[model samples]
Target chain A: MTAWITYVVTAAGLTLVALIRPFLGRQNELFGVVFGTRNIRQDQVGRSLKQQYLIETLSLAVLVWGGLALMAWWHQQPPYLALGMIAFLLAALAATANAHRLSSQYHQQLAVPEAMRVSVDLTQLANEQTLSPVWGMVLLPLVGVGFALPWSAVAWANLTVGLVVGGTFLLTRHLAANVHGLAAAPGAAQARNILLSFLLAVAVVAQGFGLACAWQPAQAGLFSLVFGLLTLLGLLLLLITWLQVTRRQAPAGAVRTDNARWYWGVFYYAPNDSSLFVTKRIGVGLTLNYAHPASWFLLLGVVAVVATIAVLSN
Target chain B: MELTVDFASTVPIYTQIRNAVIQAIADGRLKSSEVLPSVRALGSALGVNYHTVNKAYTQLADEGFITMRRGLGAMVAEQLPAVDPHFEAEVVPQMKALFTEAKVRTVDRQTLVALIDQVYDEGWHH
Candidate 1:
């Protein structure tokens, strides 16, 4: 029963992230396709499309949950559970991609080309908007305590938690330092700061879960409830942040409508663009400029780290 | 200070960056001893190569408009260097070319002088 509950909670969290992603950016961008703010936000077609997308996404989530429940009823196999999880992710991605296609069709009808100009403020360049990375130091003691816990046999689990926390810390710092916000939009910076804080919270929650693993079987239910509540609160916070950010005024800087620079309506690729990281159009945080030379190195480093962790975990 | 570069312009990106910095300094938007953004930061922000920004900084330092120190980034010099023979040698030909163009365009000597005064005053006294 506890395992079933865990599966449900994890599925719900994943679905929630998928549902909220479309609203993480300015309302002008729908499923990664850029449209005029007024047209996209106020047009009847745009409204209907967004409604349709939400309905489809929710229905897909329900179907995935039903399938998972059916699989659980038929057999208590670990591989079946993994299959259910994979199905949920694939379904969510397909829905999002369909939405993107619909949005692109609408954009094509307009036939308007956006300026490719990028801008930066000299006065703001020196200011660091991200939270100090020193705050990551708070996790070290938790990790140390985790190692000292009675669950010495699960030291690998504790190390995994530490690795996740440490990895995210470095990624957040890199994003904060490298990402360039073209317009002087306070909303963008605020959204980024919120994202940074949320990641820290996630890291803390992972630590809590690791420590909870050492608890006696009788206390397991209590820990699960507490963790579930914390996860719910974090998702609520994320939703609120997205709503606030989406309602903010659109960026008044250079209109970057060059569709050729984007791949599959989301990934930004411009070989001439010097920016290593650009503010994300489809999401709340930063996305890499694949054209930058440093992006390859960063990608390689991430792959190497993940491979190392996987090997060590085994 | 805000820097803007026109990518469509025929001027080289490095030259534009150098000119912008000098113009900011002349207009007093950038004060003496003010530190500039790091080359990498400014380059990424402007969507240009860091080497381009480094070239601009090198030119500014050579011209004695800014000083680059190890670990300190580029800073506006406390005192701009006095005009040297090398600078004069570079400036006279440019001034002569401008005067020749003005003369060919039938601009009177007084009008040219007045235009120079107005520009100098606007740049320095703004």
Candidate 2:
């Protein structure tokens, strides 16, 4: 009964993720947050989004059904659960890459209008404060200690994951300081606040997981349930914040320009742009300028790091 | 003081930044002895290379518009430098070009004069 319940729960979670996949990294209509190709119509965006959803659903179904078949054939001798997870992660990465490529192609097809060709005054962004160095002192010590502590493998893994979550929160704060140049603008500030809140919630949940793993491994099932609930809470908070930001009316003199050109909705390229980093058009994050040589180096470095992580994890 | 640079303009970015700062000073938007944001801070905020902002700051410092002090960042000068002899010669042509464009566009002399007066009055009052 417990095994059957686990299967059902896992399937439900995968389905939910597949459904939500289309919405992730999508541009908000009102805020102009992500890849700002105003020329791309909503219908076109919806069509591509739907296509991405279908691909994700198909990939997930293959992972679930194929894994089940293999497990049944082999009588679960080969640890089917781990294989399934690996397959799911690979599928997710592929889907993301595909979606980005498609978005960029759509952007390339759109006509650049004369009105959208405007210059932005970056001076307005100068008033906003950067991430405090104190956050570094707070987060890095925990990560370092987690690595140094003599703990069981599972406990250490949990702690490491918590540290990574905390690290990501700090990194996001740093990136947010640099990307959202117009700090005084209502939309920009609200977006930053929402993003910070979401990261904080996720970090807290990760820390809870780490603590549970360290103190109560025998109650793993209970801990998993708690983790799920906390993660859901974090997701809910993010959703609510996103809605608030997207729905809020833009303030007067908000920075608007068509300086950024997308290569495939994934890579940003602007020949005239002096900065290497630009605010993503589709999501609340920063992206690189493909036109810049340093950006290419950065991309290569990221790819190498991700590959290393994947190999090590496997 | 509010400063803006148009990334899309044919004019160099550093020059635009320098002009904006000078304009702000002339318009009294930036008061004497007011501290400006550090080059690194401004560069990060503007999403530009630090060198670009540094170039602008250096030019401003050379022109006696602002003073760059170690550890203190840039500060607006207490008294601006006297206008150079070539200042009028350089400015008149630019002003004439604008007037010529306005004339070609059929803007009346009275309207142009009124516009100039309004701009001058706003800057003085501000």
Candidate 3:
């Protein structure tokens, strides 16, 4: 793969990962609460699932490039390239399997509430039991295609657009009125921060300038500069909002200081250092964990951009 | 990570964790050989019991969804037989129960189909 393709793939992959990492965490957290919380229900679970699928597609944006890098390094031996691709497949398979198992453990405990199958419910659960084994089977073809692409700038752009659009759209739904009511509450600061984060996500993608590097244009450079700067600003906005309202702040609305808030439909269990052990430590009370996937992804983006600019200037 | 289960819901907690992890892996957040937190850590993180987390991990291991070693911790497992134990063991029976329950209530097949269709559409997304 050309250097630019690799960079583009890295960029797309990073962006998608950032948006998706927390979502998966949130989803699993919900799964964990499925049985005990007769009170919890995600009105947006299907939207979240579709969003996950889209982000997964975008992650494949880099796979093709990685495969090409392998081929380039060992072009004389197709076998070596094939081996590298196989390893990638195996690893992805393992990860995907584990994810489903996590979902299924929750599924068995799921009562399929009388209300869940309503027109507004999740279809992914339609085949809940049959879904587990089918998951790995479904991912196989995508894994193959990921190995097939030659990994170019054009492919990178397509992947980038898909990743950004899909992720932004999903994140947007979290703010789509009802979903926010759970975590954000109506009038509180948590809601405010989440709302801002939603807009910031949209702001990042609306910039048509791509990564503001390889796609920069001389004629439209001034316009690109404004938008590119705005995109960076949006990232800063996310960081600020995350830091401000998300700290051990009490939520608002029907959820008072004494009760757990239901933001995004999933219930946020009340804090108790010594409660049922799991309830005490789990949930979204700690939104700023350093090792969170999105944290790593955001760091990746910052480092990659700085390194890319540094390399070019030198 | 071992899933801290909530057994009070319509679905089990481990299933919830499994779905979330599946989504994560497909999205590329958790890669292969990436060490998952111990079930204890996950339970503490999610605020569930350690036993609940173990149940999830063990179930996943059973279906070849993940692999576990005595001290090495749980990792994503690979390429198992294409058998959907979930669907076979759970969904089909549920569907039958729904239908049987509907029949006992004297609901027509069309109503049943409509309910299923509605769920397939907006309900699924909700």
Please give, for every candidate in the order listed, the TM-score of chain B alone compared with the true chain B.
0.91, 0.73, 0.58
User: If both were scored by lDDT, which would come out higher, candidate 1 or candidate 2?
Assistant: 1
Model 1 sits at an interface RMSD, in angstroms, of: 3.3
Ranked candidates (lDDT, high to low): 1, 2, 3
lDDT by residue for model 2 over B59-86, one digit each (tens)?
9998889999997778889988887866
The ten-residue window of minimal lDDT in model 1 chain A covers A172-181
lDDT of each candidate versus the true structure: 0.70, 0.59, 0.42
Candidate 3: chain B TM-score against the reference chain B:
0.58
Q: What docking grade applies to model 1?
A: acceptable
lDDT of 3 by residue, A1-314 (tens): 44444445444544454334334322223322222222223535534543554455446535644665666557643223334445544543443344434443444556433212101111211111111212223223322333355534424543443444344333322121111122322222243335444443443444234433334445455665576567667655654554354433332312111112222222233232112211111222222123235534745765685576468558
Q: What share of the true interface contacts does each candidate keep?
A: 0.41, 0.20, 0.00
Better candidate by TM-score, 2 or 3: 2
Can you give the lDDT of residue A107 in candidate 3?
44
DockQ of every candidate structure: 0.40, 0.24, 0.02
